[model samples]
Target: MVTGLKPEKMAYYKQLHAHAWPGVLKKIKECNIRNYSIYIQKIEGKYFLFSYFEYVGSDFKGDMAKMAADTTTRRWWKETDPTQIPLPEAAAHKQQWQIMDEVFHTE
Candidate 1:
């Protein structure tokens, strides 16, 4: 699941993420993240993203650490991070974005 982001910054965010940088994509794959897509709702200017992947690799933490340590990933984040509002658990700071409780789910 993704988090809510402001509408005004939507286009810039979308454009950047539309074609994720090669390095960034490589880093994500290394981290076991795949089949990711983000969606925007105009009525309330909210953002949503969905990702699915197989966690076959054992070192989840190590993979994440490696991804975070990448210079290219850092640079990509610099551009798109501002446009995102991560949930509480994922937020860099408390005020950045509030985590929403899931009320429903269907498979």
Candidate 2:
């Protein structure tokens, strides 16, 4: 998934991530997401964020719903959501991140 990062909020975003809340982290693991990572890039003076995560659960939709129902996760989003700019596709879905299509993969 991918999203645009606000230029001025970059530091705040990095700061929040540097000291990620314990409960939020725990909830992420509880959702069966592993080896998760986010990378940033500067493109034509704009910043974009790319996220990669491995979901190990059978019911992805159920897991995501559980995550959304988590208070800690909601609190975490309150801080991080403002730092992101939703692409049109994402905005249309009222979401901060847009799904990406995978063209190639190698193990």
Q: Mark the regions of model 2 whose C-alpha exceeds 4 Å error after superposition.
A: none
Candidate 2 residue pairs in backbone clash: none
| Candidate 1 positional error at 61, Å | 1.2
The lDDT, on a scale of 0 to 1, for candidate 2 is 0.96
lDDT for each of the candidates?
0.69, 0.96
TM-score of each: 0.69, 0.98
RMSD of every prediction: 3.7, 0.6
Tell me the number of clashing residue pairs for each predicted model.
0, 0
Give lDDT: candidate 1, residue 71. 99
- The best candidate in terms of lDDT: 2
lDDT of 2 by residue, 1-107 (tens): 99999999999999999999999999999999999999999999999999999999999999999999999999999999999999999999999999999999999
